[model samples]
Target: MTDSNAALNAFFKDFAQNLGRLQKGADVIAGIRDSDVDVGSTPKRLIQRRDKVELFRYEPEVEQRIDTPVLIVYGLIGRYTMADLQPDRSLVRSLLAKGLDLWLIDWGQPGRNERWLTIDDYVDDYIDEAVERICRETGHEKITLLGICEGGVFTTCYTALHKERVRNLVLTITPVDFHADVDDPAAHHGFLNVWTRSLAPEDIDRMVDALGVIPGEFMSSIFSLMTPMRSLTKYNVDLVDIIDDKDKMMNFLRMEKWLADRPDHPGAAGRQWLRELYQENRLFEGKFELSGRVVDLGEIDVPVLNIFALDDHIIPPTCSKALAAKVGSSDYTEIPLPGGHVGLFVSSKSQGALTKSIADWLQARDG
Candidate 1:
């Protein structure tokens, strides 16, 4: 073949590939327009509700379940829907399949009305009330508590305050030692920690007061900035790689959907979290208090399972691994899974192992 014919063939091949990708992209867009994409599809019932808090009990998939129900508390900034992002890739579904009775505490999007709400209200009132309701419904005095990220911090505080109520405590990507950076600056990863610590207390107060309720979009933007190049690369380079595969594209869309659905955080709560926990690094030092009660980590006596993402950019592993030394629990287990903060739960590669570890730990303590 002549050089001209070879060049023509190369051009034709390139055109065909581009044409195929465009057709696939069109199909994806059409599916989105038709509202065919679904997430958080697992069935659940609202067992109890108070203020903006809703306690949902997921329908059991297995006939036989552990006696102690597992209650999941998600971080305030993000919606709980990520756990049940899809039917096949849902952490809730996986746990339920393992015969674990699951429940979730949904702190609905806080508006201007909730500007006065603080950590005291969330931990003392909302979570306390939910736990009591769960006990009443299941006839189990002590239940398993699983907290994710900031939710883990809340659960750790709750378990410390009411150790008798929590049979087992699980914290995923939880930041326990706010000052982990002080001991080893190099190990102190996550731009969030450094950024918050760099801010003055008055600065945080001014920002919170002006906003009334911190906009979810503002928070999302800050997180995206942590890896600005990667965020851009996802849409520019990675999107094209998975566009032809419907299943992969759907998975990517589900994650994007979850990230886009961030909820506004209450102003008062936001201020307290930044000032007391992040800036002052008080939680581990027993200086943090909720409703006049000191949150002493040493008070935690329940079996604690601390799971940290090895490559967590939001919360460093050292920050999470500090739980074992601080908590008074004799049965403390720490797992360093391979993934980022969110990947620990949703990544197909890690979710199964993560789910199994949780279920097995809970089952072992069920008796």
Candidate 2:
């Protein structure tokens, strides 16, 4: 063949291969959309609801269930569905399989009217009611509290204020000491920590006031900005790489669905979080108060299991490691999982490790 003819053949071959891959990827995506790919498929009953807050109890799967039910407190920023992303990769399912009764608090998306809702409302009102209702139904005074990320901060506060209400505490990727970056520069690796710390208290107030209720998409965008290169590659390079693998593609899409489904945050609560915890670093100082009551971590003498993602960009290990020293609990344990923030719950390898560690720790203490 002539030089031009040879070049044309090579180009056509490459185009044909690329086209075939694109067609396969599109077919897989279409199938995923039409198929019964259920997320958060675990059965649960809504036992109680107060305003936007809802308390749900997952149906028991074991012959003999644990007396203490674990109440999961996911951050208000994202829905709790992340813990139950899919049947196989679900933290909920894993815990259920281990014979632990599970309960979850879903703080539904905040609206414009909810702009007035403060951190006190979440900690003092929603969390308080949920815990009491769980206690009332189970005929137990204290229940195991599992908090994730920002929810961990709230749980820590609640545990401190009402030590009698919590049997055991589990915090996953929780940022206990917001000023951790100040003490250790390694914690300053994440953009979120550095960005929030740079903002002034007045700046936080002004931003919150300007936005009646912070949009969930806005928050999602900020998280995406944390790893700009990774975010960009997910749509381009990563998607192409996993296009042929239907299982992997489905898992990726499921995670994308969860990430897109962010919840608007209450303006008042946002202001307090940014000002008191992020900006002023009042949490570590024991100066952060909810409804006039100080949230002193030293008061949490209950058994504590604090988990932090070693490779988490959003919440550095230093931010969560401080929990071991701050809490008054003699049975405090910190597990640094090998994954990113959200990956700790969904990643196949980490999911087993995460659930196993949590179950074993809780079993040893509660039994």
Candidate 3:
């Protein structure tokens, strides 16, 4: 055989390999079902419900190692399901395996009727009530409060107001100093802070009043703008890259499902989050108010553990690190983990470290 026969064979071999990959990809896509991509599948029982909020206690995965119960408080902007997005990648599962008595508060989707709900209501009323209920149910005077993102702000405010009810406060990817983003060196990090500041207070107020509730789609669009290239290529480039691997494709789909489930932010709360905190930098200055009471960060004297993602573009490290100087806790700890905002909980590398750190910290202070 000469060069002509060898060239022909090589061309056919390449064509056959490409055809096999395409067939496998097609089969994988065809087999995927709605349930295959379902997120937040960890088993949990509903403990109580109040208005749009519901409290849930996860069934124990192991014997409770610590006496103090742990309540996970996620922000209203996104669903609490994110903490338990999947069986293996779930923060809820990781902590439970460490013998934590984990409970979560779900701020159910708010409609137009909830437009009047403000930050004061979330911090002073709803959260306070949840804390009392947890105390009563667990027979523990004080429970550990683990707040994430905006929920961290709510928990911080609550701890400042009623420090006795909290034993340990764990904040994850929480921004204490909204304006601290200005100091962030990364171009991508703190776009939300800058964007929020670009708007006038009246502009935010007017948008909230006109819409009644901030639409989830609108918020999603703003987030997409922060990472425009990734958002644009997610379906095409990202999905295509993972299309041949079942596990990788499933992970991508589950994340997309979670992102699609964003809930509307209540109007009054949205207004305050944008104007009072992001715009005015009120929380860091101790000028933020809830129920006629100022939220003085210096008053949070509980054992506080602040965790922030080092590469978090959404909530810059500078924004979260600022909490250390303001809090009055004699026992304070800071954990800087690798990954971005969502990756802190979902990334395999970070989630294990995150949960273990929380468990160890809580156990040390459990007494």
Q: Model 3 Cα RMSD, Å?
A: 2.0
The residue-by-residue lDDT of candidate 3 on 265-344, one tens digit each, is 99999988988898888999989999899999999998999999999989999999999999999999999999999999
RMSD of 1: 1.8
Across 1-367, the per-residue lDDT of candidate 1 in tens digits comes to: 9999999999999999989997988787666642556777889999887788899999989974577888999989898888888887789999999998899999988888899999888888898888999999989898889999889989988898988899999989899988685554544366788887898888777878888887899889989988888898999789888887788888888888889989999999999888889888889887998888899999898899988888887888888888778889889998889988788888889888899999888888887
Which residue segments of model 2 deviate by more than 4 Å?
1-12, 34-37, 183-188
The candidate, 2 or 3, that scores higher on TM-score is 3
Candidate 3, run of 10 with poorest lDDT: 235-244
**Judged by lDDT, which candidate is best?**
3
- Worst window of 10 by summed lDDT in candidate 1: 181-190
Error of 2 at 352 (Å): 0.7
Q: Tens-digit lDDT track for model 2 on 32-119?
A: 6534556778999999887888899999888545668899998888889999999899999999999998999989888888999998
Which RMSD values do the candidates have, in order?
A: 1.8, 2.1, 2.0
- Each prediction's whole-model lDDT (CA): 0.86, 0.87, 0.90
**Residue 271, candidate 3: how far off, in angstroms?**
0.3
